[model samples]
Target chain A: MKPLLSVRGLSKRFGTRVACRDVDFDLWPGEVLGIVGESGSGKTTLLNCLAGRLTPETGSVTYNSAAYGTVDVHDLSEARRRLLSRTEWGFVNQDAREGLRMGVSAGANIGERLMAVGARHYGDIRRTASDWLDRVEIERGRLDDRPTTYSGGMRQRLQIARNLVSEPRLVFMDEPTGGLDVSVQARILDLLRSLVGSLHLSAVLVTHDLGVARLLTHRLMVMQGGAVVEDGLTDQVLDDPQHAYTQMLVASILPV
Target chain B: MMDTISSSSSGPKEHDGPVLKVAGLTKSFIVHAHGDLALPVLRNVALAVSPGECLALVGPSGAGKSTLLRSLYGNYRADAGSIRVHHDHAWAELVGAEPRTVLDVRRRTMGFVSQFLRVIPRVATVDVVAEPLLRLGADPAEARDRAEFLLALLNIPQHLWQLPPATFSGGEQQRVNIARSLIVDYPILLLDEPTASLDAGNRDRVVELIGQRRDAGSALVGIFHDVGVRELLANRVFEVSP
Candidate 1:
């Protein structure tokens, strides 16, 4: 089958500091790939490049868009790129507040995404928003409340409902569960696990937690100092790590 | 004889005293606008869960399976029944226990995994998972470390440890819920569609974890919609008819 997204010679740098170097990979449909590395590693940079949020210094990121056909993400016109991000792609931010419109009601936030996808009926949009809220475990009665009034977890769930309202084909999540209490993290992970399966979503998840990589991803990529150090199936990489960095990463997890 | 041997080997035998018992458990709801209709959800439901055994609840939708599970967890009050749970080496009636006693039992003896994850906004995922351990008087650092291990096992990425799970996908959120409930070794576990949203691979992982817990002597009561998982985990089956 044709790969859903492909990256070749992908490199990104900030001034003299290299964020990612010579990273190459292919993401198939319905696959969850995890990018694992410590802070300052190029995982986030590579994710940003792949998601078209940051321009790469060299190489190309290509996605097989059902609407636009195979296209270079970076080379697409700004309007078209925005359309793709709004329609075919989703970006889940680490800080939910950053991704959500804090000023608007949660219902409106979710409705906005539906409207962007050409949904015009007010009643239908509201009902959809309400449904999404329930799916994410938020009470339907709180639909009219602003995100500012939502608890940290509620805000994050609202952000997810907003992004997924349009049914994007691929999602880019940067620490989607970051900064939550352990109990809360577990719940979110459970939610994400189910959503990914039912939706058949292809996602590039950037996380430093090896456990997350093991549980959610089919494949894994280990990044260090802005380079792809190792890549393989999730179990193979985790159980019998080939690269020294990957070994250390695996060893660092506290035994359950 | 062969069937008896295999069944006994696979699951706890009935000779062993049950960890949880219910008798004549009935619940009803009043329909406000339907001329004061009393909608009876559960009728004389009786069941027992032995240590190291899993009792699977099988029934169609609207059969009150979830309501039965919640009543077992003390989340709902049974209208007419004695719900007894073994704790502190004695059986205590949960039907009308004091709130403090119920809370104590929940904290130390019973663990529940509900269908929906209740996310407390602004708390980090690690802390959320670690709360049970903290309540059990574990060291803060130890609790956090254990929580990380469980989170990783459930496939929650590390970066999200410090963030709230509210923004996570349905699957990710569900994994978090599993990790939290499974973190502490409660004597009795109540699971409601635990693997409803998990992929095959993750679902297997959860089954493995549950098996481990059962082997460690935890009695389990669960509602498994997935027939395969239900067959794999449940040694005893209880069918609830609507």
Candidate 2:
């Protein structure tokens, strides 16, 4: 089967510092691939490179888009890449505040993506937005409230709802549950698990939490010093880490 | 703990090779506050379960019974060994398999029913049970209908079907959890204390459900606390100890 996204020898550098190097893998459809590493290990940089946010210095990032067909992400024109971002792709930032418009009501936040994709009926947009809020477990009563007033978990869930409303096939998330309470994190994890399964979404999730990686990802890449040190199934990598860095990372997880 | 295995059609299930095989698995739990005191639990535990068999894990408390269950499910990081699961008509290593491979195995072949019910808050009880099918891309209506059927079979009141099971009694919650696990008809099933919270009647129903699964050629490995349930369901029992 053709992969939804393929990468080969992708490298990125910031001045003299290597941000990422020689990253290569294929993200299959409906698969969740997790990138795990300490801060500054280049996990985020690799994600940005894959998302076309940071242009790599070398190598190709190919996407087999259902909408645009097979095309190298970096080769796409600025307009087309932007179209791709607003259409078939979704990026969830580490901070919900950065990913969402705090001033707008939750309904509008979800509706904007639909509108960007040519959805214009006012009643239908409102209904769909409300439905999305429900899907994300946000109450319909909160649909009119600005995200700025919501709790951390609610805002994060809303951000997810906004990204998913337009039905993007692939999603890139950075620390989607990074700063939440443990309980809230479990709730969000559950929501994400169901969403991924039911929607058959293909995703690239970047998290330092091995627990999160174990729960949400299918394959895992352990990043160290901007290079992939080891990659394999999430359970295998966590349960039997072969690389010293991967072994250390797995050991670092506190027992619960 | 109790487990049962109804081996395959050959001389024995072992003749066909167990569908789930574990060998040389070892693990230790370290207590960090106590100066990293390592508590070694499972010590080179080995077992195999063939299709149409139910293998039970029976042992005293602290005998690492639960640990063995979790290790078999790829929940624990074993110090050494292999958990070879024969799925999709091939042997896939679980001890060090990739997350993608493990998830794929879980989706299509294996089902693990832990003791508790962990569901998204506020989702209907029937919907919670229907979710596995939904994730497999089944029609939402058909999935819900099958969930309703299971709930009815398990004696979940029709009036409470739309309400979340989070507020249900412990016994009710366990039944919901079992129904969810049984919904998938996985080729290999791992169950832990599935009937710990149920009454005799409901426990009997769970026994029948598991029996039906074994009859349908699904290999089951379970830890049942109830002796009656174990006797009714497990044809082969494997013992464990510290």
Give the top-scoring candidate (DockQ). Answer: 2
* Model 2: CAPRI class: acceptable
Q: Pick the candidate with the highest TM-score.
A: 2
Estimate, for each residue in A106-220, the C-alpha lDDT of model 2 and write its tens digit.
Answer: 9999999999899999999999999989898899999899998999999999999999888898999999999999888878988888788767799999999988888788888
RMSD list, candidates in order? 22.0, 5.9
True contacts kept of each: 0.00, 0.33
User: How many Å off is the CA of A51 in candidate 2?
Assistant: 0.8
lDDT of 1 by residue, A189-242 (tens): 777876886687999999988877776777788999999997766655676465
lDDT for each of the candidates? 0.83, 0.85
Q: Compared with the true structure, what per-residue lDDT tens digits does model 1 show for residues B1-242?
A: 11110111112222368989999999875433445567788999999888999999988899999879987877666678989988876788988665445666787789999766777555688888887767666777877877888888777889998998889888888889998888788889999999988899889888888877787688999999999999899999998888
lDDT computed for candidate 1: 0.83
